[model samples]
Each structure stands twice: as C-alpha cells, then as structure tokens.
Target: METVDLVVPVKSLTAAKSRLRGAADHGVGDPKAHARLALALVLDTVTAALAARRVRRLLVITSDPTVSLEVAAVGVPVAPDTPGGGLNPALERGAHLLRQNDPCAAVGALQADLPALRPAELDAAIERAAAIFAAGPAPRAYCADAAGEGTTLLLCAPGSALQPCFGTDSAAHHERSGAYPLQGDWPGLRRDVDTGEDLRRAADLGVGPRTREVLAPCPHP
Candidate 1:
C-alpha cells in the first residue's frame, strides 16, 4: 500500500470549537476552561492522525503558534499557513506541501476536532481509498460527519484541482464536487464536534484518552 499524508487544519485556539465557547458564560467557571477544552480536542485529534500507519508523515496546518504544546511529543511537523488566510487557504498550503514532498501521496484533509477517532479505523478507510485510486482514475473521497449532515474527512490526490469541501452541508457539497464517500468504522471520522449535539454523540462513541480527560465526564449543556 502507498504511504499517505494527513493534513490537520486548526483555527486559532482562542476562537476554535466555539459551540462550547461559553461553557462558562457567566460565573459558572473560568473562561479559560473553554479554551482548555478546545486545545484538548486539537491535541487528541493530532495524536490519532499520527498513530495511523499509512500516514507516513503528519502535517499540521494552522495559523496558531501555540501548537507546540500539543504536538511536541508527537514528532510531526508543523507548517504555518503563510497565506495566513482561512481554512481553505491553510488546507491548500498543506496540499501544496504534500505534493512537493510526495508527489503521488494521497492527501487527507482532516478537521482538528475529532477526539473520538481511532487509528486502525482511519487506516482501513485510507487503504480502501488507495485501492479505489489504484484501480482507476483518481477521485476525491469524503467521510461523512456524525450528524450525517456535514463532511469530516476529505481524501484526494495531492494537488488535485478541486479543493476540499469543509463548510455547511459539506458532505453534499463535496459530493457535488465529485468527491465520493468512503465507508469506515471510525466514529471520529463521522464526528465533527460542531455543536452540543456533536459532543454528546462523541461521548456515546467513547472519545480518546486525551479528550475524555479534558472534557467533562459527559458533554454538558
């Protein structure tokens, strides 16, 4: 099987994972607690991506400089989005990096919020996509979100002209853009943690050690 490259996109810690933004809106607790939770999710997601065997190398795409704490022990490389734009631009930069290093490597565009993802499950889906690519012309592959409303995982040819679809209704948007959906057992791939509902779903699936450690015993209202 061909090795793959995974790119994880993370927004600023100060503003990431906003659904839990005001977990302590009033005097419930310290405001920094929310930021702490956001950072934990990012770290766990990174750890899972690094754990995948097919992912020879991992690249973290972000504008935030605080990634050092999360990735320091993972040994993965970090590349700041020089374009310094939004999500798409950061992912585009990551795509460019992958194409330059491993021209034929399939790039996995990952959202940095899936704390319940497991390595083996992700590798299975990746191997499946590689099989599909090797069988014929390269096509984009998408992994649906837990709610089944959005997209959580995007795999495509490195440097493919069609960028990843990551916004609202992203599953359909990516499908419309010629990205095929790949089925896998990874709860993480289907969990985007965008709202209170997503968090509850992740808990039901049993989140990673890091996330289970950071978040409350269960997703709170």
Candidate 2:
C-alpha cells in the first residue's frame, strides 16, 4: 500500500478557534477553558490522523508552546512553523521538510479543527488519491469541507508543491489551482468545527474521546 506523510498546522491557542470560543458553554467566558478545548481539538485530530493506515508519518507544524509540548508527548513529530507568515507558509515548510526525507511519498496538509475525524475516512480518501496520482496530469487533490466552500484536506503527490491556499472559499481556490476534488461520504473528515452548530454536528457524528470528555459536562449549545 502506498502511504503518505501529513502535515497538520495549528495556530496558537489564543489565536485559534475564535469562532468557537463562545459558541459552546464549555468555555463561553473562560480563556483557560477555551484553550483546553482548542488543545483537545488538535490532540483528537492528531490521534485520528496517526491511526489512518495510509498515513506513513505525520508532522505537526506549530509555534504554539503548549501544542508543541502536548503533541510531542504523544510521539508525533513536531516542527516549528518557522515562516510564521500564515497557514500556507507553515504548511509549505512542513511539506518541504517531509519531502526532504522521503521524496517519493505524497505529502498532505490537514486541518487541526477536525475533532470528529475518522481513520477509515482518511484512509479511504488517500486510497482514492493514490489512484488519481497514478492516473497522472494533476498531482494535487483536495477534500472539501462539509459546506463545500472550505477545504479540510489538501494532498500533493511526490514532486508536486503543497501550495496551500487555506481561507474563505478555499475549496474553490484549490480546484482552480488544478487540484482534483475528492468525492466521498466522509462526514467526520469534512465536519471541521468552527461554530456552535458545527460542534453540534460533530457531536452527532461522535467526536474523539478528548473532545467528548471536554464537552461531557457542558450543556448542549
């Protein structure tokens, strides 16, 4: 089976998940609680990605001190988002680093907000992506978020650049850049949390243990 390396970029806790901060009663007015939630999201995302059979290696690109410490503790490699420009730069740096070590392996950029990510869904997407790569022409592909406006995963075949354009309408941006759109029923992988509604949806789909634990005591928003 062809496996791939994945780069997951995480923002500092203080700057992460602004839209979700007050969306849940878990941490509506508490910075500490909000940070915990943000950290839990990253941990869950990392855990799920690592569990995917097609994932050969996963690197976390982050400058957040707490995130760096936590992810390292779990045995996932950590690299500083040295460029510090934005999401794309951070992803590019991590992809470049991974390519340096394993030039033949495909590299991918994944979002850090997918607390409900499923290992099988990710494996299925990568399996499909491998087929696309073998077909040739476009060496990049992306999985759109649930709304189909944003991107949750961007993949680049060996020798292709991971030029991530993550922001508003990122799914359209990726497609315009010649990345084939991945089609599947990967609800857990596509349902990245941003709002209270998004969280509710993730809960319905079943979140990872860390996220579930954090929300266990909080009232449903």
TM-score, each model? 0.88, 0.96
Cα lDDT of model 1 by residue, 102-189, tens digit: 6777777888888888888778888887777667545678888866768777888544553777788888888888887787777766
TM-score of 2: 0.96
Candidate with top lDDT is 2
C-alpha positional error of residue 153 in candidate 2 after TM-score superposition, expressed in Å: 0.5
Q: What lDDT does the true structure give each of the candidates?
A: 0.74, 0.89
- Each prediction's total of clashing residue pairs, residues at least 3 apart in sequence or on different chains, is 1, 0
81-169, model 2: which lDDT tens digit per residue? 76458888888889988988678779999999999999999999998888998998589999999999999999988888888989999
Positional deviation of 40 in candidate 1, in angstroms? 0.7
The lowest-lDDT stretch of 10 consecutive residues in candidate 1 is 22-31
Worst 10 residues of 2 by lDDT: 22-31
Task: Give the Å shift of residue 78 in candidate 2.
Answer: 1.0
